[model samples]
Target chain A: MPLPIEIVLFIFLLTTAVVIARLEDLFAAAMLTGIFSLLSAGLFTIMDAVDVAFTEAAVGAGVATVFILCTLSLTAKREYQQPTRILPFIVVGITGAALIYGTLDMPAYGDPDAVPHGHLSAKFIEIEEKAFLSQDKHAAEPAQHGSGEKAVGLPNIVTSILASYRGYDTFGETAVIFTATIGVMLLLRTRRREKKVSPPNRDQMETTS
Target chain B: MQWLGLWHYWAVIILMMIGLYIVIARDNLVKKVMGLSIFQVSVIMFYVSTGKVEGGTAPIIPEGGHDLVYSNPLPHVLMLTAIVVGISTTALALALIVRIQEAYGTVEDDELNAIDGAAL
Candidate 1:
């Protein structure tokens, strides 16, 4: 019997995670993390989460990996030696066991009757269903649901909710990005006059730039 | 039935544990950041998995298919914002690591702590 595609992808993902955990070389770990994100994005696509897959592909594989690579250029590529790992390992093992125990009570995958699916999401899906019916009626039938025709006129419900229903939340997220960019600029940028104090460092910086 | 239904959660839990171990055990600050990214991605997986519906396609509504089942859109939207925020957080963290390297000439947690102890 052929294994499911997700099972194959999960195997690849687990392998990458293990390799990243054991590797001492920072650069290779960074590269593998990119592969890890790309694989998860593929998994998301297989799960019918195109919007999520797109965002993960863009942010995880693209921006996060680039950031790690840039940081690597500024730091040493090798990790320092640590004396012991027994405590952290045990701690993580316990936490993992606890999380697994908690998962015993969670709703199963793709369960339409799950609590999250049965309430607000059902309402949204209902709106989409009504919209489809209205479209089928060819102007002879009005939308049965008020929210359907007024759902920001976007066929992509995720986009509509992100930009319309949850507009303020998205605005807050954008503000967070803005703040982070400013913080990065402040942390990394040095004044031109200050650069005169460290001529060799200035030259290295200029060369890298 | 049980294993097939809960496999995704178990897989996610394992990934999360690996990420947590890296964050706690790694000496290099950059590796810690990578671990944190992995942890965040694992959480995204958890939420997206919960949002899945049997026989559902992408959340995009087709032109005239009323019977079509689309996956829940709310989680996808939330995770999109989360992905953007995660990238920004990673960017800022890396910038801090760069500054830490410049100041202490080391990115190892122990070395930085030792340097601080000496100064104190």
Candidate 2:
């Protein structure tokens, strides 16, 4: 019962992806990209990644789409039709085939005993377990609040891991965001005066600025 | 043999290849970026798939009790940061595109190349 919608969402995702790849109109493609992001967000939710889904819906579907439309306004709307090339198709096929062959060793989807679950994930889960599920009757040691070690003190284990365990990565992420801001500002700066030239001749438009 | 179990990974791979194909094959810069977005999201899907447990719920600690299996939180955290980074990349790429459009007056890869070839 739970998986029926899950499968449907994946199907929708695949469909939207193909359509996006084939569509030539940049406007429609940008809109479909938003649809694709929302569909992927739905898939994320079904896979129990609510936080990821929320962020994807907001950033991927919401902000990315708007930014794209903004770019579209400032640039060409219709993509110029070029003769299709086969070499890239062959390259994608070969890479995809190799990747598929590699997946044979990957753990099955939703496998609880997969290697990732055994390491730090289990401990992260246990930390929260000790807090709320003190009466856990599993083979693990009884929830001895034996030491004064406080539970993560937050309900969401994801946040605790991100803020504390992986704080350095978050710092790096912040730095990355800051650097991106600087890059955007530098790239978009129009320093010289602009001529009222036609949009097609925009190459020299920024030169005067 | 166990294709049924690995179907999700297969689809993810296909999606990735589609994204790669768009990046490699398409002449339009914006479409390539769209493909890049799809590719990034598909990778996110793969990692999130690995984070899922058969009977697991979201990685939030529940108030009533703790018998429920919570999916792996590490992947979610990593992917959260990844999504943020992804948007940043997209933003930065779009900025570059805007600059490219201004300087070349076109976003087509071949056209831009032609422009450069003429200059040389």
Candidate 3:
């Protein structure tokens, strides 16, 4: 029998993980990492959690990979020595085990009777059409009385939430990007004195006799 | 075969862990960064995989109103923004790498550390 899609996705994820683990070269690993991200994004499409997938694809796959590659280029690719740390690994293992134990009480994946489906989600899906219609009716009545165009313009609730309801968060995120940019510029910029001492300066004086 | 259902998620988690391990354990700066990439990609995979529905197709609205099952479009939309962010990050990082290469004679972590130590 053909494997279930989830299983297949799992296999892909596992394979990528193993590959990433064994890879020695930094560049190759970075590229593989990108492939892993893309594959994960594909898996997310299969799952139906579009929003999380989107963030993963953008930040995890795109930006993070690029950042890694950039850092790699700045540093050496090969490890000079093997890690001898055992205590940290043990600590990590213990922590992970504890977390997994905590998750045992959580609902199974896609259980129709799960709390999320039974509560808010089912209600939202059931009433979405009615909500849209009511908004439409309200929009039809109120061009002069209120800003009708602004009220029902965006289709996706998440978008509206991001852009309007939580606009401050968005503004903060933008500020973060701006800060990062400035930080990079400040970190990378050379002083005037450093810039003036070209490689040829010492060589030229020595050659002139 | 029997364990297929939940195994995929576990696999993703494993991959993520391995990637993270490389990032933290490796002494080479480049290797560490590569590990970071691996870690990030695994997370993307984990999120994307969570969005799948059993029998769903792509979320594109079919022409002429034919009733067809489609995947959710929200993930795709979110992914576009992510791609843009990724590109921007990559550009900035690469620029930093170029600068680092110019400043340091070698990119080896140990050598850099030694140079830094000497400077101090």
Candidate 4:
């Protein structure tokens, strides 16, 4: 039933990517990248990643588009056309071919017995069920919970694992975002002081390009 | 030849290759970053695809909903946080692009290289 929709969305994804590639107007390209991200978010939704879809729509499509547009305002609007480079094409082709060849031995899509679904995810899902179960049991006792009966007591499995089981990794992710914010802020801030370092001597500078 | 099962991966591969080509072939710094974004998202798609079970729904378990199969939420959590973090880093990248444009006249790779070669 939904497979057709998935195929259609995947096709649109490919089409949008191609259009973005062919587009020369930097502004339109930025807009198309947002569209591409939005399409990918829809694909995520179809694949049952509701939270992933939400974040992709908001961050990937929304904030990212705005950032790209802001940068375009500061820089040139049209991409400078260069002569066709065969080396890059060859490189991409080889890498893509290798990746395709690598996937040949992988399990079929949506196979219930696939490695990821069979291992840690199965345990996590059971934990999620238990968490939900304890929520129901909470109405009866209301005191016996959160010690051992309830593990990662969030109704949403993704949030449960993210906040509890994977807390350290999420902390690292937050740290990365914090560092990026600091980097951006430092880069964009206006300096009030004059140049600190001495200018490079013109005698030593040579035209090498 | 399970074409029905494998075609999705192949299509994703093509999309990924397009992004890779753009990153390598495009001289525009902003465009390269966008290509890099595409590449990263494709990886998420590949991982999420692996987490799907045939009859699985989203991983939000309701009260007494244990009988229902749920898609693996690990990839969803990883990719969700990753999307946000990726955008934060991309914002930093764009900020650097803005600084590069201010210091130099263009964001083209070769032009920037040319400017660097000729000046101290």
For each candidate, report what fraction of the true interface contacts it reproduces: 0.88, 0.82, 0.25, 0.85
TM-score sort, best first: 1, 4, 2, 3
- Cα lDDT tens digits, model 4, B50-117, are 77778999999877765898999988888877786889879999999999998898999999999999
Where in model 3 is the C-alpha error above 4 Å?
A: A1-3, A51-71, A77-92, A112-129, A133-139, A142-153, A191-209, B1-9, B40-120
List clashing residue pairs in candidate 1. Answer: none
For candidate 1, what is the DockQ-based docking class?
medium
Candidate 3, A86-110: lDDT as tens digits: 7646654664566445435544443
Native contacts retained by candidate 1: 0.88
For each candidate, give the TM-score of chain B: 0.96, 0.96, 0.77, 0.91
Worst 10 residues of 4 chain A by lDDT: A200-209
Q: Pick by DockQ: which candidate is best?
A: 1
Worst window of 10 by summed lDDT in candidate 2 chain B: B59-68
lDDT of 4: 0.84
Give me the iRMSD of candidate 2, please.
1.7
Quality of model 2 by C-alpha lDDT: 0.87
Model 1: residue A87 alpha-carbon error in angstroms: 0.8
Q: TM-score of every model?
A: 0.90, 0.89, 0.65, 0.90
Estimate, for each residue in B61-105, the C-alpha lDDT of model 3 and write its tens digit. 223323333333333444444444444554455556556666876
